[model samples]
Target: MEWTLPQWGQLMTLFMIAIAMGMDAFSLGIGVGMRGILLRQAILVSITIGFFHTVMPLAGMVIGRVLGLFVEKIAVMVGGGLLIFLGVNMLYHARKQGEAGVLRDLASFWGIFLFSVSVSLDSLSAGLTLGLFEADTLLTMLLFGWMGMLMAGAGLLLGRRVGAWIGGYGEAVGGMILIGLGLRFLL
Candidate 1:
């Protein structure tokens, strides 16, 4: 491909989208990391999240590609709505419990899996939107996975350092990020 200005713009947009999607993982990781996980556990959790970040979007893209044939025009809207809903749900939960319930155990396989899936749900919606627009799938997936991994790691480490100060507020911040991104997509 020629890597034109439009392509560059698309790539930048994709990168932003990846970060937006990863914020959930990052925020939730912070919440979970507050409980003091070992380095090994952190690595395992990050890897699991990275895997889900890639897989969920790939699945969404496939579904979106198939759905595009029928609802092409509204796909972006649907994707935006999904993000908003997820964001709102996160905020609600955070406010209700003031913490990520059941996320305290990062050492367990199912705990890691559930956390990974919860965080990656936004990527799936973003993938659907990108698929609707016929974006570069390989590039999108790569960026999503890369950003998700890096962000999750950073969040965990940061949480270990400052999680006590922020406490449960990290999830609220993360929820706001998602809502902002969703609004950006909508407008």
Candidate 2:
């Protein structure tokens, strides 16, 4: 079957959004990578992050679906507002310095779990907003999980070889992407 222009656009949008959501994972992975993680540990951590990214957004989408039932007319506005809020929050945190002890103990199960959840929180928010739209659920989730895993894995490996400066900038770029998307929704 052939695809239409709008379908292609939607696919691209979802793909970009998935990458944006993974930026946090990538940034944090860089931090962890800088600390010297084993390949095994990195793989495990990446899988965990991918799981959270998938689940969180799905949960958000469910909630969003419920909300859409009550406020169909204003759902778009609410979604846009949420996206903007999440983006600004990301930007704010990205500007902060001091990574001392922020990424310690990632070797522990609890530590890894907490870190994964924290990074995937934005995916939840993005999912909530997406719930308002006619987004393809399976495709979105797959993109998010896959990108989150790949990005995190890359970050961890790169962290060992690169400087810590990339983490903050990565988050900032992700924030900008989110903000731009939010504005697009509003307009």
Candidate 3:
């Protein structure tokens, strides 16, 4: 078994990447927190997203390794598609909100999990990219997950404050972000 530390420069690269990757989640988290979800619910949402951040990329890596040169676009397309769908769905729900909210309390764990998974689909695609570099999966996941947690925690706080002011429009914007990211990957 080989246990490797991330190269000092790779660690920096991953850290910056982590922040970039967390942008969507941060935006979504703001909306979630603004909806008046309890602290416990926010933590659950964070954990779910973090877990997906770890797993999706690992899965992508495994698949990419097997499929070799043929998998990047597939992973990217899948990831981008899912993000757009999630974002669009969020916007739709927001449009239906009563000017004050979109998502309700986070009592539904499965719902949270699925949302987390959808947003992190791009992370899987990113993981495939990382795998091509022979990066350490465990280290990579740890870096990604921690970055998500920090960003999400901040977003939850900020979203709670901002969501109330913007109402469901925040969610609608988040939806747009998802769609934009997906399109970006395609081009």
Candidate 4:
């Protein structure tokens, strides 16, 4: 397959995009792990994030196809907005000295699933953006999933070890990074 400019751009952007997208998972993982989540919890969290990274983009593609071009643009805008919102929310939460409400609530599968969906919404929309491109959806989703897993892994691994050194505040910083990246897409 002859790679178009967009596809090439997508390839170049994939890693950075993944890193940006993964920030949320990383941050949340850090917070969750620091609070003593186990190895099973970490694996499940990463898997859930990975699952959403795959599924959400496909859904985004479907929405883009059915919802028309204007809606597709709207999807990107919405995704960007959500990224910023989540980032700000994380920073705000940082000021508070308690655990994340989501972490407290995520004692079960359903709860984690919900969290994964919520965080992966950006990736879902990102998938839509990728879908809009004349690029390979499978490759894009795979890249996205791997990146998400990697980011989540970093978070969990770090969280387990020295998260307390920073009082587990890396998540807020990660959230800020995500917000910046999301805003960049809009611009």
* Candidate closest to the true structure, highest TM-score: 2
Tens-digit per-residue lDDT, 62-166, candidate 4: 665565455654766665665577567657765563543545345698878887887687777666555554346777678778878777777777778864555
Scanning candidate 3 in windows of ten residues, the lowest lDDT window is 97-106
| lDDT (tens digit, per residue) of candidate 1 on 42-136 | 88888888888898888888888898889978877876776677678767766765533646666678878888887787788778777776778
lDDT of 3 by residue, 1-187 (tens): 6534657767765665556556656756776776666777778888878888878878866765666455545755655565566557667766765554334446886688677886577678667655655566787788778777766667777766664555455456656765675566557
Query: Backbone clash tally for model 4?
Result: 0
TM-score of 4: 0.70
> What lDDT does candidate 1 reach at residue 171?
55
What lDDT does model 4 reach? 0.68
TM-score of each: 0.84, 0.95, 0.64, 0.70
**lDDT leader:** 2
- CA RMSD of all predictions: 2.5, 1.3, 6.2, 3.9
lDDT of 2: 0.87
Which of candidates 1 and 3 is the stronger one according to TM-score?
A: 1
Q: Residue pairs in steric clash, candidate 3?
A: 30-159
TM-score winner, 2 or 3: 2
lDDT value, residue 179 of candidate 2: 91
Model 2 spans > 4 angstroms off: 99-101
In angstroms, how far off is 77's CA in candidate 3?
A: 16
TM-score of 2: 0.95
